[model samples]
Target chain A: MGRWEPNATDRLVVAALELFETNGYENTTVIGIAERAGLTKSTFFRHFQDKREVLFGRSSLADVLAEGIAKAPADAEPLEAVACALELLAQDVFTPERRDFIARRQAVVATHPELREREALKGLGLIAAMTGALERRGLPALTARVTAELGALALELAYTRWGSASRDFTEVAREALDEVRSAAPAR
Target chain B: MGRWEPNATDRLVVAALELFETNGYENTTVIGIAERAGLTKSTFFRHFQDKREVLFGRSSLADVLAEGIAKAPADAEPLEAVACALELLAQDVFTPERRDFIARRQAVVATHPELREREALKGLGLIAAMTGALERRGLPALTARVTAELGALALELAYTRWGSASRDFTEVAREALDEVRSAAPAR
Candidate 1:
């Protein structure tokens, strides 16, 4: 029903992840990934700029998540707004096929110091953007920043738990959020 | 009238920071830093295991801050307890010399990806410890985690601003907390 041009990008990503897991991230080249995927070097470069981008290519998710948060209903509380934003992000940005891929990507990144630093920077950038959105909603700067950070922490915990082989992402995220709420001081 | 032997650890840290700023973090070795501080390789190793530790030797402050939060008066609200804990930490953990040293260390870490990840992991560990403290106070798990994350966020923002050339740490922290309160939705 839909016109798809062989989904070259997905093919590239899958090949890259496989090569990274088997041969180590540093040892896998763009040419090797392309060859494994049955594509040419030009096709690989057409989809990704370099080897690092093969694993870290979804940085665009940050912008999409930030926009979702910024556009959340104004009537919602800061925490609720952030949660809704994340839920929407989970549905839109994290598909089941991509989920396993992401888990492997995270594992690879976690093992490499340089990749971990890049991941940290990416997380910081998302939190900063969310903070800005909250500030625009008449929240004070520090409050906005705290709310954003809290949201990020919750997301991180949920992602880590969900990425485990035994769990599903949605259920894990819901449980994680509930855990966060239950831990709060009574009003 | 003072009967204090010079702190060999502090001297090493200072020398390391100076060398890192002058010669770049990767270029400055442990032996060079120790020599500049009039200490030997053994003395440097006694104080710090590696060059990286010189920039990351502040985990003790996290322990003190967590302990202070755990021991806050029973009647204080979670956020209030956290603020009080931070105040105590500022007095006991962050001396004037340490403040300047930390600021320099932050600049160096910010520029290097590996150092940044180490900082993130350190921050995550501190937040987890604080969350456990809040849970022990009967706060729900989620709430405790959120509150701890918020506290860390506030501290990070305050510290970054204070660590700048123009501001004091305590003053910036107080201001940041006030901003957080003001940003909260009307109850």
Candidate 2:
């Protein structure tokens, strides 16, 4: 069995974010990040392919969201399923400490156009995952796709709001989900 | 006034798409596109700053939609204003021939990750414009942002449906708008 390296990936992420904020993303190298984290470069590579991956890569994020959607009640509507999924993600994946890191990372991403694009792609991937889950639940293709996109948008809004204060992520997320649902025109 | 060069830009776009499809985006060059279009390289530079711009740049599209939104009736809701703006874009910007080229360009973008990122940025730009227009219409900040995102998502859904057959872009766009609005969970 491998030795326990508890929070190894999280340590690398925090180290990378600190270096990125102090030295800028372009100037911060993987070796520097690993050293700052008191970890080896090989360990860094094991957790992330490169420095940018340290900022953007979170494969488990999609898995958490998709699993949440899959575990929603069988009779839930497509939008409700998405809402449940995001709420679960807010509760399970994004703890108070991770929220702080995410806010800092957002600030860094805003400064660089390439990072912004990568962040946008990550958002799209989340939406795609949610869409796939909804499709498996037998919603029509277009409905599933639109609900997933709305869910992503709500998450973004909630995260932005949550970053500015000490509000609960779940409360902020529910408010965002409510905002989109209320804005819909009468059928 | 300078001498007329009617359809100069259109010709370049067609040539670029054809060459991108035939030679691949990486292999295609500005010189090859100009030659294929029976135009000078100087003329190519006049319309597009570079080869990739031919596939991605269209500044006037956002202008058309924003203008349409601004001209909507004063009493129109934020989402209604967005729908009006998108209808104008579908009618004024996306003619049948343009749709054909757009489809080809979308296919090319699908083949390249870099192009896909550029495409996503362009989509973000459109949403930003719509959001700004909605804000001007007196909607709250978050409402404007979310509605604008939904507008962009609707346009994307409509365009995808339109590409598979000969359909009215306005009708498809409206249907997408309707679908999302109807799918909203009850308050």
TM-score of each: 0.71, 0.86
Query: Which predicted model would earn the best DockQ?
Result: 2
In angstroms, the error of model 1 at A121 is: 4.7
Against the native chain B, what TM-score does each candidate's chain B reach? Answer: 0.86, 0.90
TM-score of chain A of each: 0.83, 0.91
lDDT (Cα) of model 1: 0.74
Task: At residue B138, give the lDDT of candidate 2.
Answer: 86
Best by lDDT: 2
Model 1, C-alpha of B120: deviation from truth (Å): 3.6
lDDT of 2 by residue, B64-98 (tens): 87888899999997768878887898778777767
Worst 10 residues of 1 chain A by lDDT: A178-187
Candidate 2: what lDDT?
A: 0.81
Question: Can you tell me the CAPRI class of model 1?
Answer: acceptable
Q: Model 2: residues >4 Å from true position, as ranges?
A: A1-8, A38-46, B1-8, B34-50
Q: Say what the RMSD of model 2 is.
A: 3.5
Instruction: For candidate 2, list the clashing residue pairs, or say none.
Output: none
What ranges in model 1 sit over 4 Å off? Answer: A1-9, A15-54, A70-84, A96-121, A133-140, A157-187, B1-6, B24-27, B40-46, B96-117, B161-175, B185-187
